[model samples]
Target: MITPTITSLLNAKAFESLVQSRRSVRKFDRSVSVPEEAIHRSLQCALLSPNSSNMQLWHFTWVKSPEVRARMVPLCLGQNAAKTASHLVVFQTRIDLWRRHARWNLEQTPPSSGSESDKRRMQLMRKYYSVLMPLAYRTDPFGLNTLVRKLGSFLLGLTRPVMRLGGRGWQRVLLHKSCGLAAQTFMLAMQAEGYDTCPMEGFDAVRVKKLLGLPAGSEICMIVAVGKGTPAGVYGDRKRLPLEDVVSIV
Candidate 1:
């Protein structure tokens, strides 16, 4: 593999700077509007974020119109970020669409000649999407599937290392994790594009889902506000514990 050149190292430093500079802005300058194209570009970058099993079970809802944006202010609990921001994006996780996404992953595998290695790879992909994913994602009202998964994990782990799979709650956690990463990517991309973003988790999920016309099974991970942030938007100086306190070499 090719090693990172000096140019690449410099680019890495630039990315570090970008990461360090980002703040959870609360107040945006209403006079400074964020362009639609910038939001689109940042979302494009967000689409490239790593996700579990490449299922990509997430949705980005950009609240664009003035009327809808007005409604969102109250839905977001009347936060200054929502009230003054130029763009609002709702991150949603669709755990109910697992089967469809698994099938989509299956269709992405190219047809290969029946060589041993090729056949093995193809079969592995098929089994993962068709069998394992169904086992992992399929839920029951009475928690029967959860019990089966726990039993299977216990039995498998008794002999060798095996994943401890749980029920719908675990699946939701995994999906939300990936969705949060996408949101982070989008926020950084916006920062790089000379805009600011605030990720708001304090909101009425029930009302937001209804307002967005989302299905009952869908979950709102977070709502991000975007705009040219004002000086007062930053609550205080950036603060973090010492690196040694937060991290340790193991």
Candidate 2:
């Protein structure tokens, strides 16, 4: 393992401050406009976040148009954060792109004529993206694929540990989990850039999807409102249960 240096320690402290400073700001200062460039940078940072199998099956829609943003207000339930924010970003999970992404991951492997280690790495990547991903993500209207996965796991685990996989529902949950991490990365990046964000999950998913013209297989993970925050934006002092009660030392 690499030794921790002064730079690493200072970076850790800075990150601790960033995490503490972040809040779910509800009331943005309408007078202060957040730059569009900052949003773009934060989104690029979000794309670098770790995801399942490196599939990167997520999309972000920046609601920049005045007419569209106005229409989104009602879809967001007229929350003050949505109304007063300079920008709104819609985080989405693109489950339909699984096949394409899996193929993309497979294609990223090194050539067959490379070194032995490289060859081994390439083979493992191929197996993961070509065989395992398809089995984990495929679905059917009658739950047949889910039953197959359940039985497969059960039979394989008769003598050893195995992962219990389901069908479409499990796939959806997995995609959302990755997409949510991307959303958190975006929010934290915004905070690091001296802006505030509110992640709102209380929107009408169907209407929001229609407004964005998203595909049926896509899911809206959350809508994040961004801008400079006001004093009233913070609801109260930060509060959490005691560490001993929330965490268990094993």
| TM-score of model 1 vs. true structure | 0.96
Clashing residue pairs in candidate 1 are none
**Alpha-carbon shift of residue 16 in model 2 (angstroms):** 0.7
> Evaluated with TM-score, which candidate comes out highest?
1
CA deviation > 4 Å runs, candidate 1: 1-3
Q: Each candidate: what lDDT? A: 0.94, 0.93
Estimate, for each residue in 1-250, the C-alpha lDDT of model 2 and write its tens digit.
Answer: 9998999999999999999999999999989999999999999999999898899889999998878988999999999899988999999999999999999888877688888987888888888998999899888789888999999999998989998898777888888999999999999999999999999998999999999899998899999999999989989999999999999988
Q: TM per model?
A: 0.96, 0.96
Clashes of each: 0, 0
